[model samples]
Target: MAGRWKNDLNWSDTTPKAAWLNRRQIMAGIGAAAFGGIAGPALAGLGAVKSDFSTVEEPNPLDHITSYCNYYEFGTGKEDPARNAHMLNTDGWQVEIDGLVDKPGTWTMDDILAGTTLEERIYRFRCVEAWSMVIPWVGFELSDLLARVGVQSGAKYVAFETALRPDEMPGVRSPVIDWPYVEGLRLDEAMNPLTILATGLYDEPIPNQNGAPIRLVVPWKYGFKSIKSIVRISLTDKEPPTSWNKTNGREYGFYSNVNPTVDHPRWSQASERVIGGGILAKRKPTLLFNGYGEQVADLYDGMDLAKFY
Candidate 1:
């Protein structure tokens, strides 16, 4: 009769309700616009609706939707991507390659999909936005993908880029943030097993706004550091610039570990909202590196998490 694990999103009738209604309408319209031209009446008839709530999950969809995104470019609105993502064209997406790599080339969506079988991994996605989810994502190691491209010895860092279309993503046009978001990780970090370039979610193709085609998922880092709708991957010797750090240097660190003790400049990191909580779930304490320390804590051994955090 209620959410499996009640999230704590209490939409005060005035603020969240109005926000939700407006976003849904805009997102639906954008979806229609993107497909209506191609699929016409058929596409409109086949439009997507909100998913029936997941009963088998511990944290469930409420957590899944809110804690896993850098959708702010869609607007500071948490629901912006879902609303404005209809503007992204994931079907014909292409990932470009350049920089210090020996095998610099381009990859199409088909090329990437055919490269490996999707592996389902259940990971806790901690959003810097102060919400969280335990997602059963479908993807494989970024290391494997990079190996295929033959990373060179000079590759000290790897940079990623997302596609930008101001026409469809009205948020990009507003100057609320920069366009074509960028992110980077050290070469070793890039090779970590915990780093995933996700293609699907809940066993289905990722929704367009969820960085469809493919996106990075680094479990230990904050959500923004792991970018979406990637269109490029580069091997470089110099430290690459990242979106959040450049925009708000003091607040968004280059290495944004999931730490409950260290607070962000704007708020406390000790707790987070259980998104999609349908108005009853409690907010839970956040965890370090989103609880993958068993596998990744070693990556930062001897180094101070607080310093980078």
Candidate 2:
């Protein structure tokens, strides 16, 4: 009901909630129609095709979303990053870091990769306002990287932002979300084991749309909290505002967790359509941390999930 999803070039005026909901329902019905028919296998086969994000045998659900993202900065559409990211210049990509740090310098992406080991840690990625995915992230633990940085005592917030290259990325030209997409996490949260500084995925170079240069992966928080295409990483004393929160305060939050009880302003945060999993497929019930809550529930400690979420 709030925050328009419309645009002049692609998206039309926001559809009436009833019609859109009905369309979605009818689509689900169509999928159900094939359930009893010989086409059932055909429909089921599509899930394996769309969800082919991980080469691992078990195929953790979290790895599927992180590996295949709708990050349009590198390009539009869900599959764009997986296909077009190889064209991005990641070899010489440099992350310009500033703020509360003793050693503030532009570090090349290669150097950062060399310092960190690429561990395939599967994490649950739950988006705000319901929707979830599993991604087998190929990267090192955030704790290991933060330990190397040696943060000062005053640091409390860790802010991340995407690089702005209008000539290369046409998405930056419009105010779809924000020019240099920003995201932040508390000092302790940024350094947690579940928090990852990913460099690659599916045994390939980091896709440009999915934060090719580098991206943060916070397991317990919403997808946006884990900013992508990060060109800057800073430690700050004050609470840093994120891109969506800055633009729409009521809709977005700095600590947006995947809480089914606490609904977002525009819609309920209970369920999520797992995109790229297939168009005819049904959106599964979103889990806390895309379903790995057991591994990260304690991070929220003495706080209220409803308020923070």
Candidate 3:
């Protein structure tokens, strides 16, 4: 299962693993010294096999990835998550699994990661705003998690919810687009091998601002489809409501797949500006499914993407 999918990117496309390991070791030592022999999770290194799903493009810098984000729980600004997410306490994070699963209950982070094998997937992350980045996400398949929970026969959709602590999250105080951000996926889409619950970035535990502990990563869809800081997962017979879609269905669709032919009501989705490419970076033409169409296009067979989108 190491290289199940076709490898579009060579090993040379990413930073050498040896260099990253050495850097992690140094960071761990510094953390141990600073916290009196207690290294933080951020200093801990995750051992993962490089995924075949990784893209060939060089990934965005860690700073750019972390600093520029869309965690609306923190704020609407791109830099707000980096500045305010620290206030969030994920020490005892637990995700509530309910609806149509056999094992419907609150599962701790430890329980979630217990039998999971993490993989390093460097994927093209396309935002609905027409910006994109190559990100290295470390996680296990969502299908594995679904198997552990035992999907019921009637389950048709998978719904997700982000944590909403108004005390810690300043943005939640304002009614931007509803408090607890929610998103959903069809059962088959949720079970796809490419769908994962990312727990790390660049081999280190994911920073708080970037959905620490765990987050959903659906590479073929728009970035918002991959909900962060997930707190609830529900298996339902009906299509679950999504925050963005509920806010403005005309602009954001439930499928939210990257389709170059479909322009966003306010902007063009035909091309995207690469984040961290600095000012004046040439926009590149957007690809269907953000270039993962070969793997996911069939999921929408016989249906009109424009209508569903």
lDDT of 1: 0.71
Question: For each candidate, what is the lDDT?
Answer: 0.71, 0.65, 0.88
- Clashes found in each candidate (C-alpha, N, C closer than 3 A): 2, 10, 0
| Range of the 10 consecutive residues with the lowest summed lDDT in candidate 2 | 45-54
Candidate 1 — number of clashing residue pairs?
A: 2
Any runs in candidate 1 off by more than 4 Å, and if so which? Answer: 1-59, 62-70, 278-280
TM-scores, one per candidate: 0.78, 0.72, 0.90
lDDT measured at residue 110 in model 2 versus the true structure, 0 to 100: 65
As a TM-score, model 2 comes out at 0.72
Runs of candidate 2 with Cα error greater than 4 angstroms are 1-68, 74-87, 275-282
lDDT, candidate 2, 1-309, per-residue tens: 011223233224322223422354446657777665543322331111011122232333323444566666655566666665555565577887678777777888666766454655555567674656556566666667566667778999988888777667655656677677788988878876667787764434455666776888886777878888788888899999788888888888778877777788899877887655677878677666555566667778898877776
Which residue pairs collide, candidate 2?
A: 61-134, 62-134, 62-135, 63-134, 63-135, 63-136, 64-134, 64-135, 131-272, 211-229
Q: Write the per-residue lDDT of candidate 3 for residues 71-111, one digit (tens) a residue.
A: 98899999999999999999999999999999999999999
Model 3 regions more than 4 Å off: 1-14, 17-44
Best by TM-score: 3
